[model samples]
Structure formats: C-alpha cells, structure tokens
Target: MKRQVKPIREGNSEPGTVSLFSIAGIKTLLQFLRLGKKSGALLSMAVATAIYTWFYQWEFALGVTVMVLVHELGHVAAARQKGIPVTAPFFIPFLGALIMMKRNPRDAATEAYIAMGGPLVGTIGAFVSFLIGLFTGHSLFYAIAYIGFTLNLINLLPIHPLDGGRIASSVTRWLWVAGAAGGLFAVIFLKSFLFFVLWALFVWDLFSKYIVHRGKAAEYSCWGKIEVPFDQIPGENWMLIPFSEREPLPYRTYSDMDGKQWVDINWEEADVVHPVKMQEQGLIRSVFSTKVERRWQQTPKVVVLRYQIDYEPHEIENYYEVPEKVRWRFGISYGALAIALFVLLDLVQLMMNEQGGFFHSLRK
Candidate 1:
C-alpha cells in the first residue's frame, strides 16, 4: 500500500502562495529603494509638492515648485559655466530650494556671478508667469508670479548666505552692514519666526567673524599623519618639497577632518622637514648597560617616519577683484531687476483689485 501526502498550505492558502507573495513584496521594495536613490531631486520635489498641496491647491504648489527648480537650474548653469561642480536642487517645503557647491568659488566675483544667476533667471521665470496670467486671465498664475518675484527679491536682501550678500562681496563689504539692518527690519515687518531665526544666526556669524576672531587665523589639524621615508628627509635645515611629491589623498578626507577649514600645504613656504637639533652635554650621569644578543637575519630596509603638519586656511587675497565697470553693471542690473519685480507685483495687485474675476473666484 502506498501513502499519499496532502498539499502544503499556509492558513488555507494554496501551496507556494506565501513564498510568491514575499518574493514579489521584496522585489517591489527593492525597486522603490532604487528609484529613491536615483531620483532624489524628483522625490524631494514630490514630497515638497505633497506638503504644499496639503496647505494650498495642487496647481499652485506645482507651479511654485517648478519656479524654484528653474531658479536653481540658473545657479547650476552659472556654476557649470565657471567649471564649478554643483549638486541638483533640493527642495524644502517652507524654506525653498537650494543647490550645494562641490567646491567653493575662487573669488568674490565668481561667487557673485554664481549667486546672480538665480535671481536673473528666476525673474525671467516670473515674467513668463506674469505674461501667462495676462493671457489666460488666471489668478493662479498671477499668484505664483507674485510669490516668485517676492522670493527672488527677498533673496537679494544682501544678507550672508543670500544671493544679495554674495553679490555685495564683489561690490562692497559695506553691503553686509546694510544687510544686517535690513534683515532686522524684515524680521520685524514680516513677523515670521523663521526669518527672525535666520536673522539671529546671521547676526551671530557676523559677530563671531568680525568681532570675536578679527584678524585671527583659524587653526586646523590633519586627520592622519603623512608618512615620509627616513632616507627622503632633507639634510638642510629647511628645504622646499614639490607638492607633486606628496602622497595623494582623497579631497573629502581632508575636507571632512577640517570642516572646510583646511588649506593645501604651500610647499614653497612650508618647513615640512626639519633637521634634528643637537644639544651640548653639561655633565655625564651614571648609566646602566645590558648585554643583548640576537641571531643575524636579513630584514626589509623600508622605514617610514610619520609627521602631522598644520595648515592655515586659504583666504582670498583680493576679495573684490571685479572691475569697476563690472561692479557698476552688477549694481545696475540688480537694482533694475528689483524695481521691475516691484512694479510687476504692484501691477498684479492692481489687476486683482480692479478685474476681480478670477481672483474673486479663487477667494470663493
């Protein structure tokens, strides 16, 4: 007689159903992870959109997001033109979008150039929206245009970390002082806690740099010691070592160690290797000796001496290297753009008040 076995089942489910379900679930999860990793900008934009949609209409939220993206792309374009590496725009729901630099600009002029790109192109984006509002008679477009113009104008407030502040670096440091006052007024006028917090931080940064650490060089230490062979030590008291002769290390390794305060070693000015100093003996003290014996054997002759060297942070000698003509041009362009945006805002407000068609519908 032959014995038969019953079909395998999971809680009355068919055989292999649970296994197939688990495998499919794992595959879906893996695909989602891969998409998240690859589409960071898209994912962030989606998240920001969702958050904004929670508070406002989806159309307005998406339009605002696109405007922010356009502004960031302007920065990206300018950075790439100057051979600088920059990351894609990352959106924050309330704070707006920003791009991070892989490397800092070489001069204040370069910084201003990169900073100016945003508002310049962002203004064009707003203008386009304004035109669309006029053509379609849509209050939504007008609202987006107004916000875009306001955001770009606010960015030109000459505050540190803001586009205006950076542009002022190439123009004049005096603007920073003006920025502080303006920022305080803005905080008060806007009555926004976030703006107040930003203003406070900016004030603290200014105080720390100008008042607390004025004219003082920042100190930094290396993450790891550099190894030099004993035979390679310079015989002279001081000698210059070619920068190329130094070991190549990852840029991130040093950058992470110094919090972006570390500067490359200036071999010509650096005293990397120093000769040993000898001191004269005044008297001889009692010494003990012990006999040590070892079998003679061949050993590797390679020996490395380790050293840790500190470097002063790199500073731009000429912070304002932009020409007088260029500075004037930047100032004029900045002022003109700001004035135009203000005019547009006024025009939009007038249209909303006088026409009251789409704007009234939106209110309803």
Candidate 2:
C-alpha cells in the first residue's frame, strides 16, 4: 500500500490570511533575493536554467535549477547575517553558482559558517525532495533528491575554492596543502574536465604560495639595502598589511616604475621602532611576495628604474605579530565530514541495483 503523506498545511489558516510558515518562507526568500549590484545573478540563473533544459526536459531542468537556487540563497542569507555585503546568487551553466562577497570576512569562523550554510540548507532541500518522492510516487522528485545530494557532495570535496576546502582551510592555512592533494586525487580518479580546470587553478595558487614564502622577499639584517626593481615592487595597486592583534595597515600605489625601486632599512627598529615585534611574521610574507612576482614578472624581466608612489622609508620588518585564532572546532568540522560521508554512502546505495536503487525504490 502507498503511504499517505500529510500536507504541510492542515487546512486554511483563516478566511483571508496566509499561514505563519508561508509568511516566514516568503520573507526568507525575499531577504536573500535582495539584489543590489548583483542583479546579474538573475540573468545568470535564467541562462543556467535554459542550458539545463537543453540537456534535460524542462521539468527536470527547472527542478534542478530551483535546488541550486535554494543552495546559493542559503549562502546569501548567511553573508547578510554576518554583516558582509555580498552579491546575489550568480549561476554558471554546468559548474553551479556563487555569491561574491564585497569585502573580506571578519574572521575565519565567519567564513566557515557562510560556507556551511549552503550545504546545510541544500541537504534539507534534498531530503524534502526525497520525502516527496517517497510519498507521491514521483520519479522527478526522486531525481531532484538524488541530484541535489550529489551536487552538494561534489561541492564539499575539500578542494581549494570549494566550500568544504574553504571551511577546512579557515582552521589552518597549511591545510590548503591537503586541499591541493584532494584536488589532485579528484583529477586522477574522477577524470572530470571540471576537476582538471579547478586543479590547474589550485596548482597555480600553490606555486604562488610557495614562491611567496621561500623566495622574492628579503629579511632585514642590521643594515641592508633591498633594491627591488620598479617592476619587482610588491603591491603595485593596493597593499594590505595585516597585524594579528590590530587593524590592517593599508597602502595604495600607482603603477609607474622608471627602472628599479629600492628600500634601505635598519633592523634596529625591530626592537624599538614599533611597540610590537611584527607579530604574525609570516602572515603576509607569502601573500606579498606572490603579489609582487605576479605583477612584475608578467613578461621578460625588464630593468626599470623609477619611483612608483610616495614611498615610505621605514624599517623592513617592524610590524607587530598577532596570533591566528583557531576558529573551526575539530568536533564540528569532523561532524560535517561524517554527515557528508553518510550522504555519499546513501547516494551509492541509491545507485546500486540490489539495494533497490533510487528508481527501483521509487517505483514501489
């Protein structure tokens, strides 16, 4: 016998009023759909839907698109709540969608929550679809459940730029190395062209980080002259020097290098120049180095000698260091991983033959 599924609404709330749940859902949707500069998100969403329609039937395409929309809106809501200005949900045809934050997150924990929002809400959506399929005998509902689950799983693959990867790296920046490894595994095992593309970006980022840390930057001795070519100057446009315990020191620069730029520094400042001994020593070392190299070495190394900005001549390394906060808790992070694994195992069963797969179970 087919199971009878109760409707969410018992009956009419009143003669002329909307139900509480309906109002809440509508308000939530409206809040996230608040399009400021990201009105283009709607256009992208339409394009994605059209493309999916070309690949599948309109009904299937619409269902999948709605699922993705819900997932991205989840991100939008979290960002807004965290007081981070963000763009609306922008969709990509096959690669899914994203919300562009206008500014950096307050901290690693904020970023982790924003990343988690999508999958948490998306999983709920998929589960709702699953229940609908189970009760209504609708294969389309089953497809939505399966596709939603799988898409979220792919997104949580702990690869840099992915939600899971971003969340993981927030705990410790070094974890990006692990993310890179996972990306490589995906490329070799999944053999997906998308994975290959993301992997290429990941590799470039890794190389950039390596060069930033171990190369291009100079440390201050007692007295040293660091001659950086105009082309070799770091922070050609904008520079952000962050201190762990304090606000980031920021600078803006113009691009005008005649030949080379150099800085003469005395290391004595490390002791008495600033109240703090440039805490978080390695914080921006890699970032600044990579930024400089990428800016200057676009083509052949040109020996240019000129001044670019109203340069400040100060000690080389005199910023106070700040301790990095371990925001992501092991228990919460591992819990999420466990849930993802459970979802994956369930997905596998849904695809299997003997376990009555998604289709077979739905048919009954």
Candidate 3:
C-alpha cells in the first residue's frame, strides 16, 4: 500500500491536503533537466493544489496550503541570506513546490538554514496558534498549533526529507546515525503503540540501502597544503580531489602537457590513507567508508593503503545491551504497527457508522 504521509503535528488531527515531496539534491536535477530556473514546476504545483483543494475541503485545506507556502518561504528566506536568488514560494497540495535557487548552498551554515526554512515556519505557526488557543479556549485551535509544532519538531528529528534529518546528515553523518539509534530506543520505551511497524519498515529501508553505502570522503588535516591546481575551477567549487577507488595512487603526477618524459615517482614519503586514524584523543573512527590515513604528512607518499568505512569498530566501542537490530525491532516500529492498527479500527468504525450492519452480524 502506498501509505500517504500527512503534515500532522502533535496529536491525531485532520490531515491537510498538501504533502511535501522532496528528493535529495535539486541542484543536480537542474543540471540534468537543463533548466536554469525551476520556479515554473513549483508554481504549477501550487496552482494545481490550490485549485483542487478549493473544490474539495476549503477551510481545513487552507491550513495545509499555508504550511506549504511557509515551507517555500523558508527556502526563499535562506536563499536570500546566502545571496542566492529564490524565485518564489508556491503552495501545492499533496506535492509541494520546487524552490528555484540561483545557486547551490555555499557552505554548511547556508545549507542548514535553507534546509530548516519550512519546519521553522511550522514551529512558529504551531506555537502562535497554540498560544492563541490558550486565550480563546478552543481545543481544536490548540490542536492545530500542536499539530503544526509537533510535526515540525518530529521532522527535525533527523529523518531525510524532513529538515532535521537532512540537517543532521549534512552536519555530521554519525550524529544522525546515533540519533536514529536513540529515536528507535525512545520509541520502544514510550509505548504509545502508534508507529512501530512503520518504524520497522524504516529500519528495513536503512539496512537494505544505506547501512554500508561506502561513499568515503577523506582529508588529512596535517597535510600542509599540497597545492594541486585545477585549470578552470569554478568560483563556487570547494576543492577536494576525491581519491575514490585505488587510493594507493599517490597524487604526485602533475600536468605534463609540455611533453616531458616523467619517471614513476616513489611517492611513499608523503601521507597515507587509513580508515581509522590515531588522534590526540584516540582512534578516530570514520563511518561506513574506511578513510585511510586522515593525516597526510608534508612528505611525499605513494599508494598508501586505502580503507572502507567500517561499522565494526564503532559498534564495538558503543556496545550497548543489544545490537541496534534488536533494539529497533521493539521501538517506534511497533508504534507504526499501532498506527496501522488504529487506521484499520477507524475504517471499521466508519463502515459501522455508515451501515449499522457489522454489529448485527456480530450479534447473530
């Protein structure tokens, strides 16, 4: 079943018609799509959503529409701060807008803020609404605020597409991993019994896909400026020549376009790559991809050994009572199952309400 995700906040509230759909990198997509501006896609989506919801549920629908708008505004706001041009914020129902950016985020700070735009708005809206509800004494108003606030907070919880999850991954991938573990544990401990099975499905998604996804990026801090120059580097390019595969290849081969017969240099004097690095504190463990020797000495080094990111050392160090596998099984995944159960029950209730015949069958 294609489970529909709603922008629900605190308690079980009515779902707004809009859903925000996002994939990892929109910048890359621009290149693929060969489009300088992507505001059109977002605009069209917003218009369609507004039109659709206008015909259907107008009032409850408007809140959803606003949240979607706020989310886009976040992107626009962040982009403006970074001196990047954001075309517009569109309000789309179910599928939200595509924020058109003049350029990609320049740095971590820029990325974090831009990423955080939507949820922050939701948080603010939720809090404001909540406070208003307190004054007006309407439980429903408070519920709306709670929904907005709670959804934003939950989205910030280090799950992808949700602001927090993306931010966590961008900042420190390991922190996000730890957060996942913690979230799993918390869900299990707090047995509200709502989202467990869904959590289990998420766990399965993690293991099946990204667990050992070996995308390793290494930088030796001690490497005192090995200046490898590029011919036509873009102004926005953050230069880090990635040694993806055969790391044994020391980066000594300079441009010989002048046609000089070069000897195969012994580059072993320089730094080497290792998955685990010895630091002032201890062995600094990098995640999944082994980052061979993190500290490249000023001296030359040849095909120093390369290492993939390994979880063994980390798992050993953070040895809890049980493996993450077992820990997650009982956690919010169960709550997800509960959610499924609740849905099933609600469906039954609705059917009974409509027919008043299911009970008759039970009595017979």
Candidate 4:
C-alpha cells in the first residue's frame, strides 16, 4: 500500500495573526498598512500613536520622522535589491515608518546588506546635505544629514541586532547572544525608554534564534550552550529543550576538561553587555525597571533563517535574529550629531547679524 504525504502544521496561527490589531476600521487600516501581521496589541499601539501624534507635530519631530524613514528605507532598498518582498514605508506621523518584511532573510550576508542599506542611504543623504551646506552656508542642511547618518551609525554597532551587531555575531556566536542580552540591559539602565522597549521586544526572539532554532551542522561557530539562573535555567536533560510557551532564559556556564566542573557566568562574558535597552526612540538611557515596560509597542518582526542551526532544550522569553559586523562600524557615519548641530544652528540663526531679510523674513 502506498502512504499519503504528510502535511506540515504549525502549532499557532501564522505570522500577522497576533491580536495586536483589533482597533477600529481606520486605525486598523493604518496599522495593517504599516504592519504586515495582525495583532490585537497593535491596535492599542495604533490608538496610542494617534493620540501622541495629536499633541506633538513640531517641525523638529517631523524631521526626526524623515530621519527614521530614510534609515528604514535603506533597509528596504537593500531588501528589494536582494529580491526580498518588503511592504511600502508606513508613515507613523511623529513616530516613523515600519517596513513589513514578508519573509526571513536567507543568510547572514543578506541580512547585513539589508541592515546596512538604511544607514548607507542616510550617509549619502547626509553627504548630500553637507554638500548643500557647503554651498548655501545653511548649517541646517548639514544638520539634517547628521541626523540621518548618526542613527544609522548607531544601528551599525556590533552590539547585537544592529547592522554592525550581525558582523560581531558571525565572528563568534557566544558573543552574539551575549552582546544582544548586554545591549538590552544596557539600554534599560541608561533610561533610553525607546530602545529599552525595542530590546525587551527581542528577549523572546533571542531565545528563539539561539535555543529553539539553533543551527546545528553549519560551518559557523556559535554559542554551544547557555546557562541561566538555577531556576531560570532549563533542566539538564538536553532532550527536554525547546519549550516555546516562554522564551528560553539563557545564562552562561564554563566547563573544565572532561565536562565535569561547571561554573556560572555573568554579563562579563558577553562581548557587549548593555546596561539598559538600545538608543532608539530618542531615549538615551533606556533602562527599564522591573516595573515599567518598553516604549516602542509596534516592534517589527525579526527576519532569520532556519533548519541549519542545532536545537537546545529550553525557552527564551524575548529573542531576536540579527546580523554581524555591520552593526559595529561606527566610523561609517555620523548623521545623528546633526540633531545637536541643528540646535546650535538654530541658535546661530537667532544671533547672526545678517544684512539680508532671510531668517527674519521667512524662517523666523
């Protein structure tokens, strides 16, 4: 007798089935337009964003939107070049656009290029602005470029998830997960609410990428094992790994020869142990206390490949898929500084003893 082909069934609903998009029709439409998957929680985020945008529509805030959009588009453009299906940029008023990446990127190189694409665009934009500034003597042009490029540079840090971060991960797997965890904690301690939330969002993703869907036979070296707090750590039984109900709580342990003695480790092992969250959302000190949560509610889904990595028997609360090297290349750009520069220029405009009636006639 011939056997019929078996069907593959995932336990939960597919991507975009989350309950974060249960708001009203218009809000729902906007959320869907920006985000790919549907979730009830996203609806709440939409409501919140709409309310916040109502109060703050200042030019500076709008300019920040432009900076973020350009940064996101850099990734989008790279994705398009790589033949990845990407949604149009979703304009979120004072916030910014969130690209809806339909599928996981195929490899590290692809991810890196996509991640760098945004910063690259910003760098070019900044260069153009700098050129414009050189010609017109209008410092604001340079300031805009600075704002555009600086954020990209920050994203390029090899800490984890950032474009530069992926580069670091590709070099050493242990450092990659450790870097991600450290970056998350650092952002929280720093009081960067925006990045703090983004980091929190990755807690579960990290577990998924490192533990649940670990690459087994790949030629690349990765974190072989992670130890957590006695209670938080998974059981010693390796077969019991991959409990997805909760994200894996990964910790560190070092073993001596013959695998007898084991010692617990800490953030010191991580290549980059961030005190709080990342520096996104404009909050530098993005450390989240045990009480508060992250600010950026609408976290974009992280893209990652699968089946090649080995599996671990545990759970990760919030995991994220990221690239390597490109995240750490700070020398590549400096547009964020433009924000500060623009502030100073505004001051200069205030104090300049101009002969013509330009600032007084229009800008003022």
Give the least accurate 10-residue stretch of model 3, judged by summed lDDT.
273-282
Stretches > 4 Å off in candidate 2: 1-39, 215-331, 344-364
Candidate 2 C-alpha lDDT tens digits along 1-364: 1111221121211224655557557456556888645556776788799999887777778878888988888788888889877777889987889887765554556777788778778877877877786677666677777788877876776667888766665565566676677778868987889889997887765775466434443232211111233344345442243212211222222222321122222112111111111111112211011111212553444222111111222322312111354443632663575486477548545643343665554434
Give the winner by lDDT: 1 or 4: 1
- Candidate scoring better on lDDT of 3 and 4: 4
Clashes of each: 0, 15, 42, 100
Worst 10 residues of 1 by lDDT: 276-285
TM-score winner, 1 or 2? 1
The digit string of per-residue lDDT tens for model 3 on 100-133 reads: 4544443444555666666655555655654564
Top candidate (TM-score): 1
Give candidate 3's whole-model lDDT. 0.43
Estimated TM-score for each candidate: 0.66, 0.56, 0.39, 0.43
> What C-alpha lDDT do the candidate models reach, one value each?
0.66, 0.56, 0.43, 0.45
Q: How far is 7's C-alpha from truth in model 4 (Å)?
A: 23
TM accuracy, model 2:
0.56
Error of 1 at 6 (Å): 63
